[model samples]
Target: MRHWRRIAVTLLPLLFALLHVSGVLHLQVLERLESIIYDTRLRATMPGTMDTRITIVDIDERSLERIGQWPWGRDRMARFATELLDRQQVAVLGFDVVFAEPDGSSGLASLQRLAQGPLAASPGFSEQLARLTPELDYDARFAQALQGRPVVLGYYFTSDRDGQARGVLPTPALSRDRLRGKPLRATSWQGHGSNIEVLAKAAPAAGFFNSITDSDGVVRSLPLLAEYQGQYYESLALAMLRVATGYSDLSPLYDAFSEFDHDVLSGVILAKGQSRLLLPVDPNLATLIPYRGPGDVSGGSYRYISASDVLEGRLPEASLKGQLVLVGSTAPGLVDLRVTPVGRTYPGVEAHANLLSAFLDGANVLQPNFAPDFDVLQLVVTGLLLALSLPLLTAGRAVLLSAGVLAGLVGLNLWLYQVQGLVMPLATVLVMALSAFTLNMVYGYFVESRTKRELAALFGTYVPPELVEEMLKEPERYSMDAANQELTVMFCDMRGFTALSEHMEPLQLQAMLNGVFSRLTHIIRSRRQGTIDKYMGDCVMAFWGAPVATPGHAELAVAAALEMTQAVALLNEEHHRQGLPQIGVGIGLNTGTMCVGDMGSDIRRSYTVIGDAVNLGSRLEGLSKTYGVTMVVSDTTRALAPGFIWQELDRVRVKGKAQAVTIYTPVGTEAEPLAPERQQRLATWQQLLAAYRAQEWDACTLLLRNLHAAEPGNILYSLYAGRVEALRVLPFQPDWDGATQFDTK
Candidate 1:
C-alpha cells in the first residue's frame, strides 16, 4: 500500500510521453519553442562575413530620394539595365520587381489617340507625332534595352480564388503533361500577376518572386517549384541559379520507389547537356532558406550597391564586372519587407539573394520526410527512460539524470544540424524531455512533499517520534491501509484499577490515570521506539514494526514491556509518598503475523493492530494476576528476544484460541543472567510439572511443597500446588497432554 502512491506519482510523466509519441497531442507550443531555438542556433552559426560573388542593386531610401520617388520612368530603368550589362559587364541580372502595366508616363497612347481622332487629316500633326513616337514609346525602348541581354524578370503568383489573371506568363519550367499522373502537392495558384508582353518577350528568362511565410509569419523556407494551371514554375532564386549555371532543362526528381507519384517530389534535377544537380526539398518541394547573415548594406553577407550609383555610373566598373546582380528595392515605402529567423523586418529581396547564394554553394538545409519519425523516437526514448528511472532515485540524483538526458538530446540535435547539415525538428523532442523532467521535479517537491507531511502528522502519535521523522523522508513508502505483516504487540494494564477508581473522587481518579498512562506511554515509545496503538481505559495497547519497519521489532517490544513494569513500580513509590493508593501494572507481549493499519468506520479511525497475536497479548495481560507476575510474554517473543532471560510459565490454551501456546516471563536481560538460587528453583518447578502431568500425585505434592518453602512469596508455585491437588481428586485421562485451557477472556 505504501509504494503504490510512489508508483502513481512516477506514471504522470509517462502519460504526457504517450500523448506526444502517439501524435494524439500536437504540441504547438513546442513548435514555437523550437523556432526560437532554431533562430538562436542560426544566428550563432551564421558566417557574419559578406559574400562577394553576388551584388544587390538596392533602390534604397537614398536612391529613391535622389531619383524622384519610385515608378522611375521605364526609359530610366532601361538605361539602368543596359548600364549593368554593357558598361559594368555583370555576368547575369535578375529583377525582384514586376512590370505588369505599360509605362504610360510618356503619354504615347494619348498622343496616338489625338492623331487618330480630331487630327486625322492634319499631316503636319501626324508627321510630328510619328517623328516623336520613338522617344515617347517607353515600353518599346525598355524592351529593346533588355533584348540580347542575360536578364531574368520577376513576377508573382496569386492564391486568392477571386483574383483576376493579367499580363503574360513565361513558359512553365515543367509543363503539365510532363507531370501527368504524378502526385505533386506543391503550392498551387489560380492566377498570376506577371510582366507585360513586350518585357516578357525581351527577357531571356523569368521566375516568380513570391515568398512563402510559415504559419507564424516567418519566411523560413520557400517552395522551389509551384503549380499554376497544372503547370510548374520555378522561384526567382532557382531561375537565377539556372541561368548562372547554364542549365537549360528543369525536371522533377521523384522518389525511387514510385516514378509517377506526384506526392513524392523529393527534389528537382537541373540538367545542362548531361551535367545535372539534384536540389533536395521537403515533401511539398520546398527548400529551407539558408540565411547568410543580417542583410546590412555596409558589412552584411551580400554587398548592396545603390541603384542611383549604378545608374549614374558613380561606382567603379571593376566592382560589378562578372558579378551576378539582383535589382531590388529596400525602401520602406516599397513594402517588400518580411519577418525572418535572422531578422524581424527583413527585405524580401534579400531572401531571394540568400536562397540564390545557398543554391550556388550547395549548402541548403534538407528536411527529409523521416525527420518527424526521428523526432518521435527521440522524444519517446528519452521521456520513457527518465520517467521510469527518476522515481527510484533521490532528488539530487534525479536532477542529475534529467540534466544529462537533456544535454544529450540538445547536443545530438546541434551536432546533426552543424555537422551533417540536417535540419531535424528539435523543438518537439526537446520540449517533451524538458516538460517531463520539470513536471516530475515539481511533483516531487510540491505535491509529494505535502503528502509526506500529512502522513507524518497522521502517524506521529502512533509511532515513536524518531520513527516518525524517518517516515517523512519517504512518505510514499508507508501507507495506513490494513495489511498482514510480522510484528510484535503488547498490552499493559493496571491491576485493581476498578477498586482504586471506586475509592477515589472522579477528578482524582482522572488525574491518577492520566499520570500512569503518560509515564507508561513514554516508557514504551522513548525506550524501545514502539507505536502506541490505543488506550482501552485501564490498558495501553502498543505495537512495533508498523508505520515504519524495524527488523528487531520483537526484541524491542520485550525490552519495552520490562521498562514499563519498572516505570509502574516507580510510580507506586511516588503514590505511597503522597498518601495515594499505590498501583501495580501487568504487561503482556507477543510476536506473530497481524493486520495493522488505520481501521474503523467513517465516524472515527485508528492506527492499530488486530489478529490472533493481538488477542493473545491481551489474554496474557489478564493472566498476569493469576500468576502473580508483572509481565508475561508468549514463547514467540522469547524466541525473537534471545538476549533476554526468561521463565517458562506453562503450556496452556488461552481463551478463544484452539491451539496451546507456551508462555514465559522476561525476568531481565542477558547482561544480568539468572542467579544460581533462582536457577535451582526453576529446575525443581519443571520436575514438579512433569510429575503432575504423569499422574504421580504424591511426588508432585512433595516437589511443590519444597518449591513453595524455598520461595514463600512465589504465588506461581503455590498455584501449581493447588492445581495438582485438584487434579489428584479427579480421574486422570490417558490422552492428557499436560496443557491447561481457559474458557474466559
Candidate 2:
C-alpha cells in the first residue's frame, strides 16, 4: 500500500508532461521560452563578422535625402542598376522593392496622350514630343538597363480579404500540377503585388519578397515556397540561389507516413543541368533564418553600401566586383524594417542577404519530419526517468543527474544544429526536465527537512519561555494576519470527559484540564511546531504548515498525533498515581488548502481556519470514537505522507459534504518498522473490511473473530464485530453502496 501510494505521488509530474507531449495544450509561453533559447544559442554560436560575398545596397536615410525623398525617377534607378553591373562588375543583383506601377514622374504619358489626341494636327508639337520621348521615357530606359543582366525582380504576396492582384506575376518556380495527389499545404496566398509588365519582362528572373512573421512579430523563418492559384513560387532568396547555382528546376520533397493521412514537407530539391542541391525545410516548407551576427552597418555580418554611394561611384570597383548585391531601402520612412533574431530593428533587405548567404554556405536550419516525434519521446523518457529516479537518489546525486541530462540534451541539440543543420525543439524537453528536477529538489529541501527552527519561530509563544526567547531573536518575520495557505489541520478530543468532569469541583476540574492541555500543547508545539488554535473545553485543536510553511506537513502532523497518544498515556499514569481520573484522546488529521491567520473581530479574535477541510478534520475527530480508534486521517493526508504505515479506516460521506472521503489511521512511521505479527493482522484487517463493505456478514464475522482473538485489546476489531452481528438480524436496502453516512456533525 505504501509503495503504491509513493508511485501515485510520483506520477503527478507525468500528467503535466503528457499534456505537453500530446499537444492537447499548446503552451504559448514555451514558444517564447524557445525563442529566447534559440536567440541565445544563435548569438553564442554566430561568427560575428561580415560575409564578403553578399552586399546590401541600402537606400538609407542619406540616400533618400540625396535622392529627393524616394519615388525616385526610373531613370535614376536605371542608372543605379547600370552602375553596379557595368562599372562595379557585380555577379547578380536582386531588388527587394516592387515597381508595381508605371513611372509617371517623367510626364511622358501625358505628352504621348497629347501627341495622339488634340495635338496630332500640330506638326511642331508632334515632332518635339518624339525627340523628347527618348530621354523622358524613364520606364523604358529602366527596362533597357535590366536587359541581358543577371537581375531578379522582387514582388510580394498578400492574403488580405480583398484578394486584389496588382501588376504582373512572374512564372512560378514549380506548378501545382506537379504536386498533385500530395499533401503540399505550403503557405498559400490569393493575391500578389508584383512588378510592372516591362520591369517583370526585362528581369532575367523574379521571386516574391514577402516575409512571414511569427506571433511575436519577429522574422525567425520565411517560407521558401508559397502557393498562389494552385501554383508554387520561390522566395527572393531561393530565386537568387537558383540564379547563382544555375539551377533550372525546383522540386518539392514530402515524407509520407503509412499510418497518417497527411504528409509533411521535407525539403526542396534544386536541380541544375546535372548537379542537384537538397535544402531542408520545416513542415510549413519554411527555413529558419540563419543570422550571422549583429547586423549593423559598422563591422557587422554583411557589408552595407549606401545606394547613393553606388550611384555616385564612390565605392571601389574591386570591392563590388563579383559580389551579390541586394537593393532595398533602410530609410525609416520607407518602412522596410524588420525585427530579426540578430537585430530587433533590422533592414529587411539584409534578411534576404543573410538567407542567400546561408543557402550558398549550406547552413540552412532543418526541422525534419521526425523532430516532433523525437521531442515527445525525449520529454516522456527523460521526464519519467527523472521523476521516478530523483526521489530515490540523494540530493547530490539528483543534482548530478539533472546536470548530466541537461548537458546531454543541450549538447545533442547543438550538434544537430551546428553539424547537421537540424533545428529540433529544445525548449519543451529542456523546460520539462528542468521543471521536474527543480520541483523535486525544492520539495526535498523545504518539505523533507526535519528542522523545527521555522516552526518555533511562528509558534514560540506556545512553547517553553526559554525556547520562546531563542525564537524571538528574529521576530520581525513572523506575523498573524489572515491569509490563505495549504496546511495540515488536526482536532483532538478527550473521550468521556463530561462524565469525568461531573464528579469533581469546578476549580479542581479546571486545574486538571489546564494541566492536561499544557502537557499536550507542549508536545504539539515544541516537537511538531504546530500552532494551538484554541482549547474547546476537553478538546485541543492544532495545525501544521501554517504561519510558517514546512514541507511534509501531513507527515509531521501524523507523527505528532502518534506522540500525543503516547503523551496521553503518560499523563493517565501520572493521574492514576495522583488519585485523579484518567482520560483518552481521539485525534483527526487532514491536509488541504485553508484560510489560516488571525481571523476574528476587533474586540476578540483568534488565528484559525474556516474551510471544508477544517470541517472535515473536526468530523474525522468525532468519528475516531465511533470507529474505536485513537486517530483518523483523511485520504489526502495519507497520500501525502506515504512514509507512514496506515490502516484504512472507512469511506464515508461526512455531514455537510456531498463527496465520500476515504479515511485512514497512521499505525507507525517507516523509521520504526512494523512487527511481522502486526503486519499479518493488518492484512487480515484489510480483508475483513473488504468483506464487511461487500456485505458478506458471515465472512466478515469470521475474519473479525480471528482478528479480535489475535489482538483482543483492539477496539476497532471488536467494534466491527458488533456491527456484523447487528446487520445479520437487520434488513438492509438492496442499493447500499457500503459508504457510511453521518447525518450529524
> For residues 1-745, could you state the per-residue lDDT of candidate 1 as single tens digits?
4444644555555566557656887667766777788888888888877778899999999998889888788999988988999889998899999999999999989989989999989999999999999998898899999997889999999988796798898888988677747648788889899999999999859999887788788988888988888788899999989888998888887765443435577788989998999788887778888888876574388889899998888987666898889989888899998889887778888889888988888888877766767876776677668767776688899889988988887888789877877888776666666666677777777777688678877877556678778787777778777899999998888887887787899999999889888888887777787888888889888998887788899998888877777888788888788877778888888899999988888888888889989999999988888888988889998899988887888888988898888888876788887889988887887788788779889999899888878888788988887888788998878998878898888
lDDT of 2: 0.82
Task: Give candidate 1 regions above 4 Å deviation.
Answer: 1-14, 17-23, 256-262, 442-745
* Model 1 quality (TM-score): 0.60
How high a TM-score does candidate 2 get?
0.60
Superposed Cα deviation of residue 7, candidate 1 (Å): 6.3
* Residue pairs with backbone overlap in model 1: 182-262, 183-261, 183-262, 183-263, 184-262
Worst 10 residues of 1 by lDDT: 1-10
What does candidate 2's lDDT look like per residue over 1-745, in tens digits?
A: 2122233344556566568657887778887988888888887888877898998888899998777777789999899988998989899999999999999999999999999999999999999998999799999899999997889999999999999999888888887567646546679888899988988889859988888798888888888988888788899999988887788788877666422544467788989778989888887778888888777586388888889888788987667888888999878899988988778778888878888999998888867778878887888788778877887789899899989999999999999889988878888887777777777777666644532465454455443454455434433334466667888999999986886687888998888888888888887888887878888878899898765557878988888899889988998898789877778999989999898776668786666787989999999999998888899999999998988999998789999998999999988889999999999999998998888888899999889888878988787877787778878886766776677889898
Each prediction's TM-score against the native?
Answer: 0.60, 0.60
Q: What are the Cα lDDT values of the candidates?
A: 0.83, 0.82
Query: How much is the lDDT of residue 669 in candidate 1?
Result: 81
Itemize residue pairs with steric clashes in candidate 2: 447-551
